[model samples]
Target: MSSDDHGLLPAELAEAARPAIAEARGKPARDAARILAEAGLTGVCAQEDDGGMALGLSFALAIAEEAGAGQLRFPLLDQILLAQAFAGQDIAGRIAAGEALGVIGWEGARDGLLRLSDDCDCDVVLVPTGQGADLIERAGLTATPTPLLDPDAPQIWLDVGAARKIGSLSGEQMADLRRAGEALYGGFVTGAAANALALSSDYLAARVQFGRPLSSKQAVRHHLARMKLLLEMSRAALARSLARDELGNPRDTRPAFLGAVGNAIWTLEKAIHLHGGMGFTWEVPLHYSLRDIRKIETAFGAGRLARQVAQDFIRAA
Candidate 1:
C-alpha cells in the first residue's frame, strides 16, 4: 500500500510515536522493540504483507525524528530500514512483529571485526562487505563493548569470522539503503537539535541572573536565534533530500545528512554552553543529546563525508 493509502500523515505519525518512544527510552532492547513494533513504528516502511504499514520512507523519517527527539537508545532506525529492505522475508516479518532484532555495523568488516553502534543483544547483524552487506546470525560472535561515549548503551565490536550468513543485500540494494539511511539519520539528528533548542530556550527563559532573565541578554538572544536558524536549515535539507528531483530521480542525501550532523553538533554544543556549568554535569540531560549527535558524527566521519561531497561537486564541475 502507498503512504497515502495508510490514511495517516507524517505529522500524525510523529504525534503517535512520541508517547511510545518516551516509554521505551530506558527499557531493555527486546522490550523496546516490542513497544515500538506494537506501535507500528518498526514496520513503518515494511511491506503490508509482512505485517507492516507499507508506508514510504517519509513516514519512517517522521518516526525517526521522534526517536531522536526522545533520545531513544534502541537501534530503531536500523530495524525499520532492515524490515523494509528485507521485505517478504521471514526475518522481515519477525522484525516487524518484534520477535527478532537486528543491528547494522556502520564500518565495513575489517580484520574479522565489525563495528556496531549499540549493544549486541540482537539476533542478527548486517555487516558491510566489499560491495554489499551480509546478514549474519549474532550467535557465536564475540561482542567487545566500547562504552566511552554512551555508558548506558555502549558501542560494540563483533567478531564475525564464525558468523553464519543468512542473507545478503546486493550493491544496488545497499545503495538504496544508504540513501534512505542518510535521510532517516538526517531526520534523527535534526530531532536531537530541535530538542536541544527547546531545552536551551526554556532554560534560558527561566534562568534569572541579577534579577533579570538570561534570555533577555542580547548575546543569549543571538545564540538562541542562531540555534533556531541552524535547526530550520537542517530540517529543510532533510526534506529536500527526501524529495524526488525535477526529472523524477532521487536526490543525493549525503549533503543533507552531513549538514544535519554538523548543525546538530553545533547546536548541542551551544546548548550545553548556554546552560553554563550545569551543562557539563550529569544532572543536566543536554550532555546526552550532545553525545548522541557526536556518536553519529564520529560513526559517519563528518569531515570525510564533507570532503567527499566537495569532491563530487569538483568532479561534476
Candidate 2:
C-alpha cells in the first residue's frame, strides 16, 4: 500500500480479471478463479507437465498480492496450494475439470470428510465431519448460515472424520503449502489495509479543519507518516516472499511469511486508528477491511508463525 517500497504486479492478468470479477458474485468468482488457476498456473509445482505450475512461487505470489489489492476474494491460492500438496497426483486436473472445489477447514487446522462444506456453484462439499477426510462428495452439506462479513465469501458446515487425504507430499511439503497459503493470505490482508489507507488519506487531505485542513495538523501528520511506514513494510514483506518463491528457495520463505502477516496486521490496524471515529462505523468499508485482514491474520497464525520461527531458529542452533 505504501510507495516507500513497491512490488510489481502482473498488469495483463489483473486487467483480464477485472471484467470477470465485475460480473461475478460468489459462484462466478469461484469459476473465474478456477479458470485462471487451471489454465496456466498449474506449473507452480516442480513438474509443470504433471499439472504443476513450475511457474515458481513468486509468479503465483504476484497473482495473490494483486488479488488482495482488488478487494476481491477467491479460492485460487487455496486450491493451487492444496494441489501442490498432492504432487504427482491428478488432483489439479480434477479441479480443472470442475470436479473439486478448493476448500479446507480453518478450525483446528485438521483434515476430514468435508461433507457439505462447499457452496456457491461448487460441485462438491469436501467437509470435515464425523466421517473423515473425503476428497469427493456430491451432496449432504449443511449451511452454517452466517450473515457473512464478506459479500464474496459465505460460510458452510459439514460432517467430517478425524483424518485422511494425506498425499505424496511429505511432512515438509505439507508444511510448505501451509506456509504458502499463509503468506498469500497475508498479502491479501496487506492489500486490504492499502485500499483503506488510500481512501482514508484522500478524505483527510480534503477535509477542512482548524481554518485549513486536518493535513495541516501535526497530530494527523504523524498518523499518516506511520501509515506510510506500514504500507512500505507490507510491500517489503510481500516482495521478499515472492522473490524467494521465484528463486525456489524454501529457507527464505520463513521470514517472508512472518513479515507478510505482521505487515498486514499492523498496516490495517494503523489505518483503522488513523480514520478515528469514522473508521469504526458500519457504513464505512474500513471496518470490513480491518475484519477481513483479521481473518487472514488469524489463518496465517500470527502467534503460531512467530512461535514456529523462533522454535526453528533454536533447533537450527
**Of the candidates shown, which would achieve the greatest TM-score relative to the real structure?**
1
Candidate 2: 10-residue stretch with minimal lDDT: 108-117
TM-score between candidate 2 and the true structure: 0.72
lDDT of 1 by residue, 227-281 (tens): 9999899888888898889998889999999999989989999999999999899
Tens-digit per-residue lDDT, 72-108, candidate 2: 5555556656555555666655554334555655332
Candidate 1 lDDT score relative to the true structure: 0.87
RMSD of each: 1.4, 6.1
lDDT for residue 265 in candidate 2, whole number 0-100? 62
- Candidate 1 residue pairs in backbone clash: none
Off by over 4 Å in 1: 1-3
Q: Using lDDT as the measure, which candidate wins?
A: 1
Question: Residue 155 lDDT in model 1?
Answer: 72
Score candidate 2 by lDDT.
Answer: 0.55
Report the poorest 10 consecutive residues by lDDT, candidate 1. Answer: 1-10
Regions more than 4 Å wrong, model 2: 1-54, 83-89, 94-99, 106-158, 162-168, 242-249, 252-254
